[model samples]
Target: MIKDMQDLRKLAYNRQLVSNNRLVLPEQVSALESYRVLEKPIYELIIDDLKTTSWTVDELSRRYGIAKEDIREPLLIAMRDPVLVAEGFVPRRVGRAQRNGKGSNVQYTLLPIPIEARIFDITLGLSLLHFDTLLVQHVDQLQFIPHDEGLDAFREIVAEYWSIRGDKVDQFISKQDVNCVLSALGPLFIPNDGGIYDRIRNKLFEEEKLLVPRFTRKKINKDIKKIRRKFSEGFFDLTDVHSTVIALSDLTRFCKYSNRMSEHAELLKISEDFFYSLFIQVHETVPVPASDADALTNDISEVSIGAGQSGTRDKEGTTAMSWEAPKCPVDGTIAEFYTVITSETAKITEKQNALRCLRKHLHAPGVFDLAICSLTTSANTNIQKEAIKLLAQLGDERAVEPLINVYGRVGATLSVEVIHALGSIGSHEAVPFLLEVLDQKRFENRIAAIKALGQIRDPRAVPVLIRCLLEPKGEIQRCATIALGDIGDTVAGPALIKLLHNPRSVIRVEAIRALVKLKYTEAIPVLQQLLGGDRSKAVRDEAVRSLKSLSMV
Candidate 1:
């Protein structure tokens, strides 16, 4: 059971958990856990009712036939919220005592929540699907309001939600969390549902009604501004910065591949350049590592990791990178540890430390091959994990088969890590084995497997991941949708378009992302229907995005 708002707020106010660095709520242990308390159907009812209007505690209980105690927590939750506090007010019973000793004493009326409150209610009620819908439902009303507070609030929500590094948002966890938001917003062209285009047109392109205003440049500039504001907010910290960078890197690719950047190529290029320098500067200013190891950005070992090819080249024919062997570090400690790892006298801790040294100092083939051999011989799980991480970062295809052979023999925890390594390696050679894992693996392992397959960008994996869409697990299905999008395979286009009708809003939203990724212009008519006609506002917003992704092209 979750705590009510007052208790949670009181705890935060008292600085109990606030002593720690990040001031996260108790519920948001993970990004995915945001709004997770609203998973109950009863909470949905309360939110829906609030969205339609607002209700006092007594009225909510009476109207829904639910006890106030039962509804109290969820309702407070809807109000307490994602950064900003809950809106709307419970009217104090003006006169609980009898008036003139006659008939009624007081009335308990619930005033409607402010616009920001409605946005929060819908967002908490819906999940990841709310960003686009929140705007569509309220943009028209925003114009009527006095200031940019509502628009600014919308921007903040977008930054908060998209900036998260979560499974539902990205197929692979980003090496950098910031990049996750970057990637999600990259190819993303959110259809301005409530005539935002009309408003922009009426404002900027008003004089020339006959001509299409060539608004792509304006859109790109707007994106740059929004991203810059998000940066100023400084959403990341040292702990999760890598994940943030990975997501941002993915966004750069996202803009590149979807070719929605066809018109806005400068956006991706400038962002990558700006963020690369900014990250390096921030990286320098941060605390030193426990060991005297090199900073991650300065490490040359990553040079070959994304080598070979980056999915399919966009129309720009982006340059392909060549892999080169890493030079052996001069320290000589790496070679000493490598030799000692297989020695009979070596303890498990020694071997684990050796693997760690190897990861830090050498990416040469001879030493890397030795790491995989440890997987079979070393019973120590810690040793195995370091070896896996080293081999994955080695960016060698040979590491794929050995990792696959060891995957099943290992425990579930290590197996998931193994699959993640395979994905990082980003080799097509791992696709077949990973697809098999999707079929044979259990729980998180299956999701990891699909994620790896997607990163490899092999066409063969497209249909297999699509088949995963039918699986009973909604989690897997969502993973499959994102995987298909990552592959960017044209073959997945029709299949994803078909999912537009899926009753599940998350699935439908993911399908739109996949279709946009594939750039299947053929789906435009269908998307228009959903944009104008879908029952779920969230799903409709996704449709608008898909349409925008194409129309902009």
Candidate 2:
């Protein structure tokens, strides 16, 4: 039997571990024996009072003979933090701390938190359902305080909360589950809850609005389930999983997919480009043996001994003949070692595939680095081609040097692919590299280089083309003159004016067109000389057309 009230109270406090309420084992019981003291009576009184009816801080403190300040902050914090209150706790505020009109003297009333804070609160709990109600209550209440700091704070909180729930929705997907996530995504679009934030969300989700359940869910459950099943069924493996996850991340904000899509996409992009690169670097820096020779020798010897003469018997008591089982060499264990190698390879592959999908979807920076690395490392030319194609699609300036570096390092076919990739990038950075390639003795690389420089359209390329134009080689000079026209820079105007007098009619025609592209009014007098002053009708006609194109009509 319990001796005193304090002892009975101690037993009750120990029994009421609110957070993790599972049956406690003897070890836990022993562990709790030394547990530090907490304000048990005060905590219990508050819980009991909350269960019966909502009570103001003053009323509760008066009822329990405890100070109001002693429980005010703790009660409020407990109600807000899920780890503390879980499902049952509710919080209410007392009469206005200030005296106002008649009804202002009302007792306890539930105080709704700001919608943004509510979104943030729900995010921490991993609950999306509360977002809509919180949004409906707080949308109009949100003040557009026109300060950058205030706006930033508002955007950051909303984005962060949206991002958290978005990720949860993406991690688990079913039509019903997605609908739930989408339904919970209501706060993202509600106006004045942060107008700028709503604009951003709406911009991303506008196209997806036509899909089923509209904005009712966080993500498209169908796509997620399909991708996840493919991953689990071995149809995807890690690479496929990485790619699908990356793709989802990239399209997350825009797709009818889960809210976390953006966060995941952003993460996958970083992992693929930065983390994967670092991982590969780590692997490279740490060497692994290519083969275990000693082990191989032992296995080979064992195999030879075991595989005694095919038809030869063992000795004495044995029958006429018996075949010994062959033993595999230790070196042959490379096949078995493949499992380990494949696992490592799979991890790297998954990281890269995910990055590639993210690069495609998000168009994030450093995507070119991943694509180029993929190209450089791939043994298969087709895979290299694919990487080059992706870099071209990205059309970023960062890709120019890497593509050129690959062209310089690889085989003829891969070199051509890289050159084409540069041409497709269409950035100013590729011009110098392309020009340098034009000076090379090889016809194939030179031709591709010339074609690429012509497509780039940077004025800086004009000097290089003019140098090529002066060369005695007919094809190179001809291509250079034509490229100068495509460059369409006024700087090329004077250079072309000097070229019109050249004996080559092709060069003369190209110069006229180049002048037209540059819109050089200074060349009109020089063109009239070519139009009729003893020049061929082809040159004359080309000059007239050039003049017309320049609006010198």
Candidate 3:
């Protein structure tokens, strides 16, 4: 009776209403083939079952004696196939009541195939299913795959998936499933695919209340302990090591952002242990070979000769001891020290001693480079913090870019260290980025940015710091006062003077000290007034100190 696509769709819809599962006619099968429905035997079986009644994957698996995993792919394919969708095979989730104390299951039912603009949705859904399946199948072996290609493909799929599903992606792919995929992909080292993780995080944030509560602290702690045990036992897959670390990092970050860090103290400690173990396993440096050392010595001798230094050659054709080339800054002892610092078998005391030696020679030729590399590559927080401190002390503009990069990639605690380093380096290049950090809503980040900005003493930050002085938070205003003083800018003088009249003695005391640093002679009268009339002894003492400093100037 079908004359056209409309007639076929109508027939298909009408057929679903009847109880009897009549045989499909040859003409009907041929008509369905035009829509590409029966391309595979699984497709045929799925379609035949749908013709009788909507079924869950579990039901289809049981009826055909197939594994649930085997049934899921074909079911997803049918739901997303363009031709099948156009022929009206729309998938809808139907909830079944709980049975035998088991939770309800989501079942897929088909709608009359639409002949409209569902093609894009169909393509996007299929693409998601395809990549999801691929990643799941090759999760452990992803290190062998081309990271850029896989990352690009997955990113594109996520973009399209987000465009269609928006915040409701959780409905299509559960939060647990998303977490599983992220755990697999987030820790990758070579591809550096944080963009994919960021996108998923943004989508999840749209329904954060619904999703975040499900990630229980107990469950996360259990997962971390299991991964850590495998990692320490040397049974963990090499490919999975980074994955485990990154997954823990993500969980730690999640708890921090959700204000649940207090509830996950054990999880954080375990995560730090995992990071330290990963660092010890992977960050070992090979010493220069003997041949390379000889070559380096020869190169140094040649450079000395070029610079008009006399280099005598012995009978063995080596440089004579009477006129030797200058020694390398990183000598054998320093090199050995570096080796011990990164050694997996080294005792804690041995490692600490090696670290001290390296710190003492931090100004040596290779030490700065080593610290920079460690800052970027080491997941251990203490090492990373030490590197940040050393790089800041070096005050080299070269460290600016690397410090900024680390700020973006690390967690809140490490980010503060990076900001401090940037400020201590005092490079104008960090100004723009530091200004951006000042705009963030995170209280800790904002405070760190303020302090860093002051240390850099960039006048460009004066206006922003002035605005922060007006905020209601006493901690913010206090920090801003110290920064303005460190910056020693006269423009903040009026704001600083106004704070002298505030009720909080701490605010008045900070303002008095800031005025003195600014050398604002005009504040000398206000300082004199405070010295005589301030109620708090601390404020009066600061005022007296400010007056004496101003009078000297």
Best by TM-score: 1
List the candidates ranked by lDDT, beginning with the highest.
3, 1, 2
TM-score of 1: 0.44
Per-residue CA lDDT of model 1 for 141-169, tens digit only, reads 22122122123323443345444323322
How far is each candidate from the true structure, as Cα RMSD in Å?
Answer: 25.0, 32.5, 26.6
* C-alpha TM-score for every candidate: 0.44, 0.33, 0.41
Candidate 3, after superposition: displacement of residue 295 in Å? 49
Tell me the whole-model lDDT of each prediction, alpha carbons only: 0.51, 0.46, 0.55
Using TM-score as the yardstick, the better of models 1 and 3 is: 1
User: lDDT by residue for model 3 over 289-390, one digit each (tens)?
Assistant: 444333222322121222212445656464321112233344664777666555667643344234445656756676666566556555655456667777
The candidate that wins on lDDT is 3
**2 or 3, greater by TM-score:** 3
